[model samples]
Target chain A: MEQPMTPEASLRLIDEMLQQAKRSFSRMSFYFLLWGALLLVATLTEYAMNRAGLPNGWLGWPILGTLGGIISAVHGSREGRKAGASTFTDRVFMWVWMAFTFTLVIIIISCVQVGQRPGPWVSILTAMPTLISGGILRFRPLILGGVLFWVFGLLALFQWPEHGALLFALALLLGYIVPGFLLKRQEDGLRTA
Target chain B: MAFAPLDPVLHNQLRLAVISLLVAVEEGDFNFLLEKTGATRGNLSVQLTKLKEAGYIAVTKSFKDNYPNTLCRITPQGLSAFEQYVKAIKSYLDK
Candidate 1:
């Protein structure tokens, strides 16, 4: 039998284990970057098409959205297989993002039914997951990214409709792409260290 | 002032380490535990078995990528015991 440890040693052991477990949560920058870039492209394409007086300019969303979904699903499963273990933090992240996706779909469907543009609503909804994810990761960039989403979302809602897509794209760039790359760099540093 | 006795099952160094790790995560694999604890395979297996026997953790055996994989998750009972153990340890330190 192994020797019993003193209370002090036991406490230290617990702290070490907690820290190690925390480090095990793989920071997922790929999803953020991927979705961010895809949304940015889709929004820009929609804006340009509308300016060009092209019919069915809105088709950019459904098409790119489906593509994004497929890529996300594939990437998620690949990452899942590579992970040696699952932490509580990982599960929380999964559920939070899943809830966001669910809510987004509902919002889109509702907007379509009522003939309202889903742009502002989607932007507003994006803030929640981004903010919650930032809080969970304790990453300040993501927290600021979440705030940017809200600011742009409101601007898109009440400001110039013609420029709404531009504001949405700006939010995606700062809120998702920039922070995502920063997070990726941080994860890379940790991995290399 | 009386201090509560530490749970004997969790008093051992290796077992305590294993439980401490388990409490932090949803589930961990045999390799994860072995790597984290730096325990020999035989020793980790023994401690894991003991924890399973104590009903502190649920162990599942499965095959992943054509290799045997053992996953361990803390049970409600295990979490409760761990909480009590922390309280006991705190009380001892407080004294």
Candidate 2:
């Protein structure tokens, strides 16, 4: 007959479960890197186009949007297939980002309809997911990144229209690229050690 | 001088490990539980059956990549039982 589970053993198991959950969710930095790089290119291109008096330079937005959508769909489906277990936190994270994506799409559509640049709206709204995600994960870097998003977001909003693209690009660099790389390093360390 | 009885169903080490994991994450799959517990396939399977019989867990069998997959989730009864088990263990230790 098996021995009864001791209190010490139960505590150990709980610790293991927590560790597993953390390991599973902590490997999401690649998404940050991917989206950040795309947005950086798009924003810089928009800025250049406006400066050069190029017609349809803003077409970068639609191109980037289509490419991003395809990449996300493929990456997400692949991740879903590999995922063996999911926690409540994972579900909450998915919904939070989903809402953010939905809101962003609506804003973009409205901007297109009104013949307005979506730069300011994009910059400000980008903070919501990062802020909430950081809060949910209790990760300080992500929290700080989200705050930086808001700071740059405000600059994008209040600054001259010509500078809006530049501010948005800066936001992506500080908010997404930096945190994404940090997370990637952390995950790598965890996997190695 | 009295101590609460440890639940017979949850008293075993592997079984307790399984429930503890399920309690933490709303659900997990067979391979995930196996990897976490570091238990042999046969032993884990038996423990899972015992938990299912006691109404502490629900198991769903589905196919993935042309392979049979088993997913397990803790039932409400299992959650209550786990809570009670923790309380009972604490009482024993406090004495």
Candidate 3:
């Protein structure tokens, strides 16, 4: 049975819901924006280093997939449990991180086919995506992972070109592995709590 | 000035569990409430109606993915009720 609500009561309810939604959504917006910009910077830097003849650019593909994988888990384990949906900005950061990482990897693979070494130009191109991912996550784990990967990636560039692959592997593990493990642990604790 | 604690009106564990979960998310889907609170469909439906009648929450029925969705968002009144519940429960510890 439908009981008709007076127009006044209906208006009051709407007003209350709107006000509550505004306050809650606004609080979440600040965090999303802060994380979004950081993701942007990372993606750009990673891409730049790869395009400049870097031999290790192929490694950025799995790295990008890894970032996306982390985002998928994050949405499931953490954000799903949250009070509200992840904002538009947060989704943007996730996609951008994926795009940059994938692009760098594809570029590097193309270069490898030509039997090229990733030069200073290539390394510069590759820096963009790592920087983007680190900035976007805004959590300590990802930030540290990005910085470590970028720094070590750069350092490996200075050594023999052949070692770029090894360096990329190490950086990938550092950038993605540690952070994923940490977040998993945190998610488990939250679930149990 | 501190006010005297009131006795718990809705002592049913299911209702209390629903309230506890809502305090965390501020809003939760009916399915989530049922899952987390471990309440049966009929029990959850009854208790949710009671909470709504008491002005603790506003439940909205909608469709998501062509499936019926029941979303429960806590009202300001509900938040206050949960807060007072905490204070009242804590009075026992205070003694």
Candidate 4:
């Protein structure tokens, strides 16, 4: 039989578990980057088309939404199947993002119905989850990203509606893509060490 | 002074490790525990059984990718025990 654990050893075991749980969130950046790239592409395409005086420039959004939904579903299932453990922290983060996604969907639908640009609203909505997630994970870059999202979101709201797409695009790149890459790098470092 | 007595079920190194891990996470599969603990398959299996028998944890056997998979989760009883154990150990350290 294995020897009984000393109190010190037991404490160490608990510490290790906490560390592992924190590390489990490393892959979160991948999802952020994925959505960031998708939104960047869609918004930039719309902006270009509009500048070219093309009608139905907004059609790209529906196509992108469909693609995004399919990709998110597949990614979610794949991650779920491969995941080893589900921590309470993990569940909380999942629900936070899920709520964010739902709110974004509602805003998008409302914007379309009312014939208003969804850009500023989307950026503002994105800030809530980003800020909360950063706080949860204690990741500084994500917090900064959240703050920038708010800054750009407000700018998009007050600025020319014609520039809303560009502003939203900037917010995404700052709020998701850049921090996402940093997070990925940190994850890789942890793996190598 | 001697340290506080530890709960026999959670006193063993591997079992303690397993319970400690389960306390942090909602659930962990056999492979996940194996990976985290770096314990042999047989050793992990035995400790899991002990925990399950003590009503400190629950194990579920399921199939994934046409292969058998086992998942383990801590029970409320287990959580309470762990908390008490920690408190006891803390008292000993304070002394």
Q: Write the per-residue lDDT of candidate 1 for residues B2-92, one digit (tens) a residue.
A: 8898898998888988999899888999988888888999999999999999999999999988999999999999999999999999999
Worst 10 residues of 4 chain A by lDDT: A17-26
Model 2 chain B, poorest ten-residue lDDT window?
B86-95
- In candidate 1, stretches whose alpha carbon ends up further than 4 angstroms from where it belongs are A1-4, A109-116, A185-193, B1-3, B63-67, B91-95
lDDT of 3 by residue, B1-95 (tens): 46455424333455556665565554668877766556689989998998889888899898755788788876788778767765654554455
lDDT of 3 at A34: 31
Return the TM-score for each candidate structure. Answer: 0.86, 0.91, 0.51, 0.90
- Which one is best on DockQ? 1
Model 2 lDDT, residue B34, Cα: 89
lDDT of 4 by residue, A1-193 (tens): 3766666777877787667655544277877898899999999999999999998888887788778878877887777777778777778878998898888889999999998888888888899889887898788999999998888888888866668888889888989999999988887877665
Per-candidate fnat, comma-separated: 0.79, 0.55, 0.00, 0.60
Q: Which stretches of candidate 2 lie over 4 Å from their true place?
A: A1-4, A191-193
lDDT of 4 at B28: 87
Q: Which pairs, if any, clash in model 4?
A: none
Q: Which candidate leads the pack in TM-score?
A: 2
Off by over 4 Å in 3: A1-143, A153-166, A182-193, B1-3, B7-12
lDDT of 2 by residue, A113-146 (tens): 9988888888788888998877876777888888
Chain B TM-scores, listed for every candidate in order, come to 0.98, 0.98, 0.87, 0.94
TM-scores (chain A) of the candidates: 0.88, 0.89, 0.48, 0.89
